[model samples]
Target: MMQTFLDLKAKQPEDLPSIIKIAFGLAAFFPPVKSEIRLDFFDDQLNEVQKEAVSFALEATDLALIHGPPGTGKTQTLIEIIRQLAARDLKILVCGPSNISVDNIADKLGPFRIPMVRIGHPARLLPSVISTSLDVAIKYSSGGMLVNDIRKEMDEKLNTSKKTRNGTERRKLWEDIRDLRKECKVRERRCTEDIVRASKVVLSTLHGAGGRDIIRQNFDVVIIDEAGQALEAQSLIPLVRGPSKCILAGDHLQLPPTIPRTDKTSSLRKLELSLFERIIKLHGPLIKRTLSVQYRMHEMIMKYPSIGLYDSLLLADVSVRSHLLSDLPNVIKTDETQEPLVFWDTNPHGGFGEDDTGAHESKSNAMEAALCRYHLRNLLEAGVQPKDIAIITPYNAQVALLSGLIKSEFPDEFSEIEIGSVDGFQGREKEAILLSLVRSNEKKEVGFLADERRLNGICLLQNSHFLGTVP
Candidate 1:
């Protein structure tokens, strides 16, 4: 076999399959595999918390919640646990409540031998299954269906496609068909089953896949990253899938379930309580738990958000091991006012007379432009790589604006820099983070999870002194 293989390799330049195999392998090289998907891991290598979570999760058929303070390596520990399980030959499915979460996990676990699935938008979940099964040629990028919402969206798209186009112009009619019209004949476009059945690892957002019958049967373990950001009811719906063992990881202080701040009183808060509280709610005692200790934040920057929620975790101690080399790389907002903030109002009624269209673009651009200038100068002064800096926003509109600004301004300086949202920025850090208050409301409202409400708060409530944090 060795001699035959050596002969094949010697003729690779002229041979069809040999050359192709070498090219393909070279393209990927080895990537960081999602550790959870791998079967074997050095259990002794994991910290005490990671080892406990892994042992308990595999043993308990119910659930294991790995909650912790911000900056702790909870996600990393889950990945390692998965790797250990893979070593033991257990198949696992990793998912999140959002697309960004799915993507982040997929990127981390790509090299493993596990089959994979990523469900985000309400339209893509079912369609993804359908495409993989039929071995359909159609591929979806974004603006697609999610697992739960796919049925309705599919019907809507189906109805939209049947409409008569007698009077429509050629270009208009062509564009409509190209985009799948209102009906996205997804079943007809691709192989749905093959995609889902072929992989051992599936990554999906929490918002769309819950209560869906298909996801329940495909994998053994379901891990929810950033568990706090999901509604209490949301987590409940997912556990029913095949009576699977659940693992939840999140830094609750940074953010909570998608529920409104006011809505924080009931289910979400109850769901978020430590395992002891949840155990009381269940028929028996709490299942199992884990806590990660590593900190990736600069000590100074950690002081702000850390002073509040993470104090009890001993994260405040500078003596604790940390991943960051510098604390507060750029501007330190010692005095809230000293913080360079750009607040823009797009609502016409807000003090700034709005031309809705350009105003959003303007506000987004100005704030990002300001932030970029800051990171560019500071990073170069400190001699850090341009890729090390990032600009994160609260919503997609700002991501688009800042993305555009970066392309237009320092296209060369930050060609690879990424723009992210609050959710996407979790478990990650950069030299600086410029948060944009895109939403406004007239009065203090407790909980409104959707972006529209947030927008209302930022655009309508236009009063800065409301939060009391602002003087």
Candidate 2:
């Protein structure tokens, strides 16, 4: 095995691609193989069916969707694509509905040497790779960032207190307040650093962005994992930004965003009267791609969902078989007491269900209450950990009493309550999910979720608008 630089140089041209791939993975640094590389998927041993699906995605012009049941290796398939593309030196931007997805990708992209840069925020890692900028890394990442402006406000309020309480108790309280203020400032700094320098593959809570914005940031390729659970509108924001290639991944059968509303209308429906009233924006065919062969689930479980794209059922007798619906009861239920799941995607409507109005409906709320009890009690009987169970509701006020009821009956079995609709559950996983459809009379309330002017939306819209109207 005598080999010299000259010998290596003389190697076959075909072997060059192989050597380059190996070096790219091992090298400390190297130039990109192509000016840019965008591939919908990357896998060597895909079955003929899966390969065809991946091809459909790559050939698409506007958007590509890859979907299936959970734990079907959808995430891993994406990672495999990144690995293959990285071998060709592609620069990728990965964004998901939550930080968890972002972190998962980072972990798979292990040992990153160069820091991610130039997207949003300042240049520089808030925390060093080894240490998150203490002033950064993770903080009140939740909005309104929970800092005690109270401390500063209190200090201002007491400025006129010339006769300070002379008691030691008063002195101690003042000192404690000062300490608390110091802590808040310190933690705020950490949170800032966390968000700023976390990584280029940011896992953010999709707080209203558009496709045009993502492309504007110069992403050569973008992969949105869990795309179906997202509204076609929200997910398309990144596409509008103009990434040369984009992949939308998620099961369309899952949840989408929730637009708030109340009294007589839902948040999204109210918004439709306001924003989309002008023109509806992004849709999937407008984009170009999709991945459909699910690698998880038994042969039977895959049969029902496949019926959407395929006419007949397909299953294998192999070990990694798809679990069919008829067999799912016994297959998915590993434990003897596994609970039942209730799901409703019914419509809300008027004029023969043509309109989607989320106004207080007796049927919707009643169904929600019943489904809530069914799933919560099922989990209780199954003895699933309380935190492992989640009942996702479409409204905030929608599930308070339901949660209270669950707490009353099976306080120890179903303690983790998630309210406020589908979007809120993004990037989270539960042993199982029982979705309560609050707006199914079929007007398509999902689209109105992105309208910018919906009052019943985020900030206390009603109070602010009606403040002066009150006596």
Candidate 3:
């Protein structure tokens, strides 16, 4: 990828596109050149703000940003933008930081019947998305039939090589097998290029966009989801591909790029700031729009972060404002279980405190783990399905302890319950969430919880019920 950028940088200034020049800071400031084309709306259910975001994306000539907080239907809005862009006969390139993120956009694009293909290794993709991958597309193409025949011959030769006792015969079979494998590669490359050329939309992770197969293909527009979670260099791999327009959608307030603790160098620290965040800070409202309505969390559960993190701009949709676990037909709710927000305080003076005695310096509190288990049992016995609940903690030690405790306490019914750290649960949500804050000590340190982005993410990870264990 670095080589690709170096080659791009070596090109003459007049040969590069405007977007690439803007990305490299070689272009002067220019106002957005709005296109006057009429856009067709595929999904009429979009809110006013969502509709505005789509309109801005289609109109902007150089760049656009969609600031989507948690549960604001960012993916839905991006889908609409792609649909509209496709209707205009524009070739689109959609990307994200991870395979799952790209797969999510591909899955949602299925119903629209768009000519789309995902590029990545099959092992990294979800099972549901493999059918739409470039490999699968090649397998079903006319060129793929030739590749398959060559592969079958290679396999037959391999079998013969293994069975033969004579060294000369085995050597001959191995040579033939090697030649057939080379032929397969040549044919597969042709198939890949053909499939990519025929598709209108290409989906991939940020790094996957730099693959040798599709690196030469030009796109009219590039849309990257979860942009704030990717490093600036990673995002630039797709942005420098000569697209006339680029749209980035993500929440700077959620999670930033994950940098290893050992990467303490000044250069690496600067790289931790994502392109989405840097652009937003520099441009602000000039090229950005925020989606204010969220349909995931209940109003009460969203109130704190909406006020503190989002300047009270985030709102709960009417359908989910009063939603609760007790509203379910079979749920047996007590006073504690009925509220949207519940705190179970474990006061250290009362003998419940965190300790790292057996956790290798990772904090763990036995009392908090037990309390999490008790709440899990109550939610399960009250008719909440195990699949609908998630156990979240700030420390891996606490996660391991909670998982062991739950498995032992409910040996037969603990398989579906999800237990993970906050980082692992960044883009996930559940009907009910149980959070364990496992830092209670003499100095009153909160560790990583002091990062406001982590706290903002935890506060918005639930739909109806939130049970937090504070020390």
Q: Stretches of candidate 3 above 4 Å error?
A: 8-17, 20-38, 154-182, 263-267, 357-360
Global CA lDDT computed for model 1: 0.46
Compose the digit string of candidate 2's lDDT tens values, residues 1-471.
112234445755445332232222321222123223454444565655455445544444333455433444566666665555455555566655544454455555444432332222223322222132222333234511465464565575356233556576567656766776777777565545444344444333233223222322455566776554444344434444345555556544434344444555553543322111111122223222234444433443344445643334333335435222223233234232322222233333322232223345422344445556765565455444555445655455546646666667766554465433444554455444454444334334543433332211121111000110000
What does the lDDT read for residue 96 in candidate 3? 96
Task: Encode model 1's per-residue lDDT on 1-471: one tens digit a residue.
Answer: 233334445653444232122222322212112244433445345666666666656655444566555445565677776765556555566756565565656655545544555544435435324332212211452223333255455455456546846545544545655564334545322234445444555565654444242343455666777665665445443443333455667644445445443534465545444322333234222433536354444344444344443443434334433323233345233323132223333332443221134422322334334444554455445544556555555556756766777677777776756566655555555533444434333332212334332322222111111111110
Where model 1 places Cα greater than 4 Å from the true spot, the runs are 1-40, 43-45, 68-70, 84-91, 115-200, 207-220, 241-244, 259-290, 304-307, 314-378, 391-424, 433-471
Q: Which pairs in model 3 have colliding backbones?
A: none
Ten-residue segment with the worst summed lDDT in candidate 3?
22-31
Alpha-carbon TM-score of each model against the true structure? 0.51, 0.46, 0.91
Worst 10 residues of 1 by lDDT: 462-471
In angstroms, the error of model 1 at 180 is: 22
Order the candidates by TM-score, highest first. 3, 1, 2
